[model samples]
Target: MGQGGSREFEGGPEGFPPGSERRSARQAEEAPQENAVVPTVLQWSQGGQSVYVTGSFNAWGERIPLRRSGNDCVVCLNLLPGTYQYKFIVDNEWRFAADQPTVRDEMGNINNCITVEDQTSFMREEQPSGFFDNNQNLYTQALPDEITLAKEPPQAPSHLWCLPLNFPPLCEPHVASWTLLPPLGVTLTHLLAAAADRSTNTLSVTQRVRSKFVTMVFIKPARGSAADARLGPAPAGGQAAGGGFALPQLPSTAAAVAAQQQL
Candidate 1:
């Protein structure tokens, strides 16, 4: 066969080997993940009816039982990058491993200590690249070795506020405009539309159900509900500046608008 044709090769495609591409892809997939967890194993050699492990890993809230291996008790955990303090519970008795490092707490109780480092060294590497600018949500923060949550929610601000239940007649030339413009019975749409607005006051209404299916309108002031707006400096003036009416600003802006309509 002289210079006429070419022979097929065992490797895939031209010049490329079959397993080379696969090997590269497999290596890529096997690469360590960001902030990857580290596997930790804890063991207690003393024999007992049941051995449990509890510590900072779960705030000591959940107790994980250790599996028996010969006379030794063992437990394996996948933990994030952080330092943890723990203790062993042997037969319902609190204790720490005598062989491991130990530290005393503020309460004068001794606890074992373990530090779990990230496999990928994510904590050491330059923080995630995508977090552009000072984006608070995306930007990472240096978290302390310890984590804790408040036992109770913060207290609410002390402020007084209320909306007027009764509204004055519509400002239209004909009093019937208020009734005819809005269909049949009163609805939320109309109530808010006719309600007065004050730059310094805010109003909100809630419909409540009665024993006989009667819809009762409950008005409430929302001015003080805004933490930012409430704290901001109050505006200067008594009244007589707004287009709706020059009535004095009251706890209920809706009531002031109604009173303005009367005049």
Candidate 2:
């Protein structure tokens, strides 16, 4: 039989330094079986200026510790899935973030909101081969439930509501006032939900009956502009204007329409 060469394991079979092997073994025992994934890092900077990020996640205004490289500042933190708003504090004063719906921080200050997508769902969709690129802003995530929405829409509460094409401004003599517009762009689903449902005669209605009122809005003629003389009037108090438009005893058979020429 041929002689077998002696084997030597680096740092010993304990897989640690010889003298400190006992302590290293203790540390390995204490450590969890699986290490957590390192959080994604975000770098914020503008025109060679270093900016600091701070917001609700880090106790509102407290500066998030960052590492500077050239002009860019970076921060990494493990954040749970949900909506979060943050702002970059540049040069200790100027705050910057996307301008849209301003989000309020925990300290009641407005900050820029950023949504952290569900990581698990996003990873599942991306699969095992590809990795997330830091430079990309848009990402795709999978929703838990099937996104099937019915096309059939709900019916409007009453046929009295009108949508006026010619909207007149407030305190003006005009027909087809802006008020006539049936709360522009209000979805049929929402209006029906607002009105009382007489089917079961649910008595626990919360909203008080609003009083009916009338007003006229006049659209001032554009300065020295040639346009048709337009004026409109509509029920000012919304559905409160009960007597102005009577609800038909028989529900509208058509695709639930609001009368236009009746007024």
Best by TM-score: 1
lDDT of 1: 0.54
Alpha carbon lDDT of residue 7, candidate 2?
A: 30
Estimate, for each residue in 46-165, the C-alpha lDDT of model 1 and write its tens digit: 666767787666645466778888888899998766667778767656778989888876456677888776667544656445525456775358775754543677563332111223
Give each model's whole-structure lDDT: 0.54, 0.43
What TM-score would each prediction reach against the true structure? Answer: 0.33, 0.28
Per model, state how many residue pairs clash: 0, 11
Off by over 4 Å in 2: 1-38, 47-50, 98-110, 122-263
Point out the worst 10-residue segment of candidate 1 by lDDT: 207-216
Per-residue C-alpha lDDT of model 2 across residues 13-86, encoded as one tens digit per residue: 22222444344345435544343433656666553244556554443435565677676667787765545555
